[model samples]
Target chain A: MADKPLILAVDHNRRNLELMSQFLGQEGYEIIAAASLEEFDQVLGKQADIKLALVDIAGFDRSVWERCERLRAENIPFIIISPRQSAAIQQAGLAHGARGVLVKPLAVKELLGLIRSLLGE
Target chain B: MSEKRLPTGIPGLDEVLQGGFIPGRAYLARGGPGTGKTTLGLHFLTAGAANGEKALFITLGEPEAMIRQNAERMGFDLSNVAFLDLSPTPEFFAQVETYDIFSPAEVEREPTTRKIVEQVEKLQPSRVFIDAMTQFRYLAADPFQYRKQVLSFLRFLVERGTTVLFTSEGSAEAPDADLQFLSDGVIDLEYAPEGRILAVTKFRGSDFLSGRHSMRLGERGMEVFPRLVPEVYRREFALEVISSGVPELDELLHGGLERGTITIITGPSGVGKTTLGLQFMKEAAGRGERSVVYTFEEGVETLVGRCEAINIPVHAMMERGTLEVVKVEPLRYTPDEFARLVRREVEEEGSHIVMIDSIAGYRLSLRGEDLVSHLHALCKYLSNMGVTTLLINEVEYITGEFRATEVGISYLADNIIFLRFLEMRGELHKAIGVLKKRLSDFEKTLREFQITRYGVKVGAPLTGLRGILSGTPELIE
Candidate 1:
């Protein structure tokens, strides 16, 4: 797992996003942190080898979801991180072909496993 | 009674339930920690889901992911089932909600109950399992409130045509009878000397086997064996003759041992008790009837080799599936498990002859001291199945005085064959005689027996002998 691929994580909370980034970084993934779609776009420009994205998808606007569609078209996979996980969220997540949706306050071990599996590590 | 029943999926449990659980009723499976209560609940949901019915597992203690992982390991696919995670998730703890009006239990249970009601209304699942039902009990401040809430929930589920199975960890704090009274049936699992035992304490409208069934909980989940009550399995078997491989020995018993009877062969060690049983099993194989020899003392290889040395085709018979030698691990097999194994061999494999090599060795495998009683029941069961069984009992004394067997199991047997070592002119000799054969005239004369590479040799009667019953007979002048 040397020369790990970069993963971009987008969250509304700075501390939560940084904590997840640090935890995954220790697990050998190079994490790029982003707070919004603007920052995610900036990170995408800088990092050519972004393996996957973990983004929050629990707002009224369709901007985050449309970005997810664009990512899917670019052959990049993403998993949604929502504050609330329900059957509707899961269905929406499946329709978008997002890897899966993780509820907020994530179990660190489960998050790590999901990241590792998606990264093919 | 005829009613709409659902199978429990666990082997032998349906038989104990006398058909299966009455559907659309709530059942409680109560057990201590690690006693397989959760697994049993999952089995019910899985069985329902497999039958194209929607199922729901509402976990109150463990997370849905952990439950799904454990269920998958046991070969249960829960894809069709929905999960209502009532346990406090990370967000539940993080969210700050003011709860000044409700008590501690109500603070937790209100939202959980609302979620369950919503899920049931939406999914309309036919089966629902509520794990750690005791958690709700703990939430309620008093016993009466807890009982009322549970009864209401059970009634709600049953009214919607949902068959429910709830699990409770039997603890000292919470009373199990509270749940037992509310549920339509109660399956109580407990740790016993032999293994875990599952018993149905109550079934509201149906009659179930009112005894503890031996249960095993492993990766494949629970397996229960209803207690082997011999009287229930009895049937009428014909009085046909089944011979031993040795021709002369068969002559001593008129024709041979009658079918559906237990034949006890008592002898000292190294006096050919096991070999004689093998001879009968070999003959059973030759007659195209299958046989199973459960040797509690020796290994299968040694038994096969010894039988092969006597020109007996133990290996060949096994190769053709006519004979099977099963070595019962010492102190491992319970009488319940052993009886089930024999029943499977006879009922499933169609084996006609059953043999337990030595009673003493078999006793070492039993948990309780009532080895004779167990043997009596098992022999009766085998006889009723029309399976002829042979038991070898090794005695303590070799000569001077003869007792048929040390275990006092002789009376339970329909026929008794006594083998002894006799010293004649400073040379040791083997003798075989039939002491008792119920309703059959068997010759009482002692015959000289020998174990050679060519198999058991039964010679003519030792005619010039007196006081033979004393084990030390003198030749007449």
Candidate 2:
């Protein structure tokens, strides 16, 4: 289990975080879920085994970009999930070194394929 | 083998269906809100329950408690009916966090399907009613998947020998055309300016009545009135004439109006057209035959009083069960509903003579529908039943132009007995004559007509007068 690739999932919604854990867990990947900024920072402190991240940027302040910058410096590949898509949001997400920006209501197949490719599995 | 039918708990609806729904098949009741779709489903389930069959109501849009309460008030006994309450609860809103990530089709469909399958296996109900099957559309990721799921779900129930009746609340944005196509039968409910109409457009494996029948949603729940088809009802009768109990009047009509034929007693207002119809009924009453007068323009008491003043003895006739005067309020009933009332009188009460007080009042009751077609169907139906029908047609014009019937419905009349207001010798007088008689030859002469406290009096043919139809007559030398 320790040798299994680990992923960090952050969302303000507990049910969405649990759904991601259950879906990705069935694919043989370990998950670390955080429902708030405080929990996200605590998981980030001990995130040495974290292979990738999926951050849903809803219900967060502007300080969330700082965390994204910190993830980039740590050389972690992550995807940003937004409630809506726009050119400004896409440009901002890319400037923050996100691997991809996905809108909310993500398709399960697309989300799984992106996670597999990001983990190089 | 003859197909087994399950009555829909509505007798009129069963008649429209020719028997009832085909057993072990799925039917879709499609309509907008407040069109009685759910109420129709309740009738289906309760009907099965009454027959000692296990019935299940799967409520998705409305709570089961509310449905049971409503059905109870409508005199429906839901004691033996089982309910599968799949409607959303307070917990659904409390757990709003589950709305995203996985689609509802992925997260919710499994448990919903499991619950339905488990309940069905345990109870094994013979009838299933889904309040609104459109709720399943939310449990599907796409339209194609929704169609497939619905097809399989219906198949599963039908294979178990369960007759399914489902409702769909369709909208302009999301029409249930696909579900309609998949259904073995489709009953569409619509609200029109006249009244609520229900039509069965598609019925597989059997035939159904093919027009928009009238429906009513009242305290007793939904009631359907099938359209009257004249060719379907017939009775053999002799080609005999009925007398008007008057010597001169019967002479003008050759004998009198023929049995099983339609007569139009047309005249201006207050020209005693209705009294003339009552004259024939008075004679029938002396013979112990029943007559029903559907008075659309006058109250029952008013008409009865007028007839009594003319020595018709309508009160005695009603007391003896030989006459009934029905007051049909305007805009109160659809044409089909009025036809049903007449049918009850003729078919059940054994009425020999049926009279509609006036044609214009009947047209007014129709709201805005075509008067001629409705009257034609009713008259044809009455004719087929071998019942003498008298229509009191009040033309708009009291005089001047020579017209037999102003409403342009003389073609519907088997005998046209027209009364005219003529000016003779600078005095306003009434003249009665026969314009057309389809069955026999009528006297080609106009006679003086008068209504008195004694009764109707007809004089000899006024051969000395000409231009009687022009409302101004001249003496012939």
Candidate 3:
């Protein structure tokens, strides 16, 4: 197992994806990025070390859920990132086996705390 | 397809959507700056919260704090709505570039789409609003890649049963036709120089009432007015003229005023336009005719005082339950709300006659590109209801040969009465003329008039005014 937690981030917006990746990358964790579900699937197939995936809920559709479900079945923990923090969404995320929900314009420190709690860091 | 829709709570907007936004279907709102797109989106989200649906707003270009401040300024409560900031970073761009095996530079430039999907799965909001989508344009150099990323993001949202409204700054250069075409619905907002009017260019999958309508951003978010179509205009039929409360003036109108027809009492400023409107209301009330006066130019106190001076006894009518007065400061009400209010009064009060103190006041209050269309819709609505309507319009130069130059309004009036200031021998005198009366045959000749403590009195026509046709009248020697 990798000593540092492995995180995969997916988003269509380059700026957001970059920001989240950099924020998480500097905190002594390995970060991977994918622009689409197809690319994300390919990355998962190639790299099995990713322990957590951060997904942007805005403008995302069902294939994303399918992929997340597959990851959950494999016992890999995932966190849902969204601009909206509605109770319904949070509940849905939790029910879908995500460890927790992270509302965006993300705070690096808060996200780190959540990851540590989920991974026993 | 089986997903639920979120109601926007805007009067006409929900109707346009055939109820509300399609539940779980993402939509695109495209516009240029000052188009009220953001305000509209915010209104939808806030209204959703009020309706017991949770809303989440994600800001890409602007700071979350600034978004909250602006929402408050627009009178929207964001306390119930969630805010998230997920701005892109550089290393994320590098990771996305690694996947672009074709171009190393592209790999370094594009952002990851997987991260965004992860966030959506986590938040699982019922409704989502992305402040803007322009930020993604730089992620992929090729349009194909950009489309793929956008499609993937949208698909993720739809699968989770999330209704999303994405705003994009429409650019004249390299318009995003592909993005617009991909969305379930598109609303184009435009701002024009004339009258500073905002108009909705088009809305797909709906029976959109065509024509430029007016919109304004005021203390109450964005208000839209759907303009009238040409098919609703009709010829006036001869009906009973109800008294305007001023006994003698009612005689000048050949009775009271025609019922179920538009009677336009136009004049220059300070010619008792509002006073005449109030008088009509008082008369209608005295006869047990339910009536309401919506005034844009005067305050409630001013209207009451002016009626008191004329001894019309407006307060007595109000007390008797036959009259209702609504004094509107144009800035406070949106055109849509104003129209809705009129509909309510007509329905609830069973008002026989409706009076707008001055059309100019209405115009100034709901300043939008579709001024004519808005008036058309208002007139059509009232006329179709068979409600006798009186509209007062103030003209700057009322002295000209009776002509209506303002666009899209002259044809709307069943009767046009011109009140002018006639200059004779270095003295200014008021005059009244029936320029056009659709139902009744009247004297077309211009006649002199006087305003006294008693009210308006008609006199003989000025025989030798050569330049009256030009609006600059010259007195006969």
Candidate 4:
């Protein structure tokens, strides 16, 4: 039997990370939750088998885009979660090699579909 | 004890509710902002706490500390009352984490429900007060769910032997009609042009006073003044006629005013209307009966001075504890409030004669209410209590077409004694006549009336003058 796919979820809000881990973990994925830049870097440095990532950029400053760039260099497909819909953040996500830019209050079905298609399931 | 009623801890409101609320039922106090809904809730819980019953105050709007401070200012002792403070804390805003995957109704309702149930089960309070029950509307998924949850919540309290009083902050966007239907009774408080009014719109198992009653929120807290219902109060008294101290004036009345009848002293300004009412009070004082004069138009000192000058001996009557002169500030009281004062005088102090000095001043106090109806209710209440009532009406026209009474309130009077400025022998003089006496016959002829320094004087019937009713008499034969 093959092990489940591993998904990295990053958000400043503890509750939002808890919600994501509970929801996506039920979908046959093992989730690694991080609440700060240090935790995100530590997980990405050692874990090269990461399948996908969901990054909520609410409390993080401008340095969060560099994390998105690092995910791109590591050949990991990821989605950026913006608190509001703005052309600047969408363009930044595109520049940083994000597969999609989802707004805060991500639609549950839409998020699941995006992850499944990225993982080829 | 299980079938006893609950006092609402408000003065005069229990009487309006006809001996307080029935136990083990939910009631709604519906009103807008600043209408004393929260104060009323505090009154309920405090009253229960005073009786050594467990009382719970579930505040959903104001925090418990602020509520306690306010209640302390109003002299409410809340030591025994338990408070379930469900109001939002400052940390709710200071926290950086926010979640929207699930709606607030889904995320918060279960925990809040658990908290309330735990508190109630732990305290076992017999009295419960929920401030702003409409706050639950946000916790329910929809209006249907809200209604179902509130109904069950209230039933849960009632099944546990708790009498509940909840308040709803009704607005145009969200009215509390559903809550009104859910509760066993509804008390509505509102602000009208006259003053703050409280009305019991619905009571399921009890009979309540059903009208707009006057309510005041003052420094001491809320006080309700029930509308006077004449038919509810009655006493069996003799129908004997009383005598005026002046013999000729009593002859004009055929004897004097009846014991329980209302007499209207209608006249022009300065035509001795108040003086005649005072004369009757003097006679009642001589008989050792107490009299009260609600002088809306005159100062107490001025009335005492004028009565003493005309030999009515108001000072002596007051000294003897048989007379009371109340100077009423018209704008300071609503008509219902004034009626309460008069009720205390007649029913509590045993006053036999009650006089409202002038109708116009009383009308001014009404401040756009239905003057005739309020006056009728007051007079009927006084009459039913077997007390003599004198209503002084000042007509605007001094010497016109001879109207019996102005302001269209003559029908409320059982006896009409009108005074006029008559032109007799090219001299302006006062004449008195009885237009109608409901209980007995009165003299048909007018009499020469005068107010001398000594006392009120009346001459024999002037049959020699015809057309005296016209305000200008002509001698015949």
Candidate 4 on B1-477: residue-level lDDT in tens? 345678999867888888788989999999989999998888888988999999999998899999999999999999999999999999988867767644577657877899999999999999999998999999887999999999999999999999999999999999889999999999999988789999999888888999999999987789999998999999999899988888888888889999889999999999999999988888888889999999888899999999889899999999998999999886888878888999999889999999998888898865547878988999999999999999999989989788987688888999999999989778999999999999988888888889999999988887888787778878897
Query: Model 3: residues >4 Å from true position, as ranges?
Result: A1-121, B1-5, B16-18, B72-75, B79-84, B88-112, B172-174, B194-204, B228-241, B244-255, B266-277, B288-306, B315-351, B356-377, B393-411, B416-477
Q: For each candidate in the order shown, give its overall lDDT on alpha carbons.
A: 0.83, 0.90, 0.71, 0.90
Residue lDDT tens for model 3, B138-234: 6665779778877877888888888888989879786878778778877667775543243434445444455445566677887665443424444
The per-residue C-alpha lDDT of model 4 at residue B369 equals: 73
Is candidate 1 or 2 superior in TM-score? 2
Weakest ten-residue segment in model 4 chain B by summed lDDT: B98-107
For all predicted structures, in order, the TM-scores are 0.78, 0.88, 0.60, 0.86
TM-score of 4: 0.86
Residue B386's C-alpha lDDT in candidate 1? 89
Evaluated at residue B446, the lDDT of candidate 4 is 84
Model 2: lDDT to the true structure: 0.90
DockQ: the better of candidates 2 and 3: 2
Provide the TM-score of chain A alone for each candidate, in the order shown: 0.88, 0.95, 0.88, 0.97
Q: Which residue pairs overlap in candidate 2's backbone? A: none
Q: What is candidate 2's lDDT per residue for B1-477, written digit by digit as tens?
A: 276789999989999998999999999999989999988988898899989999999998799899889999998899999999999998978875664766778878988999999989999999999888999999999999999999999999999999999999899999999999999999999998788999999999989999999999998989998988999999888788889999999999989989999999898888889988999999999999999999888999888888889899999999999999999887888888888999999989999999998888888876538767988999999999999999998878888887777678888989888888989878988989999899899999999999999999998998988777778989988
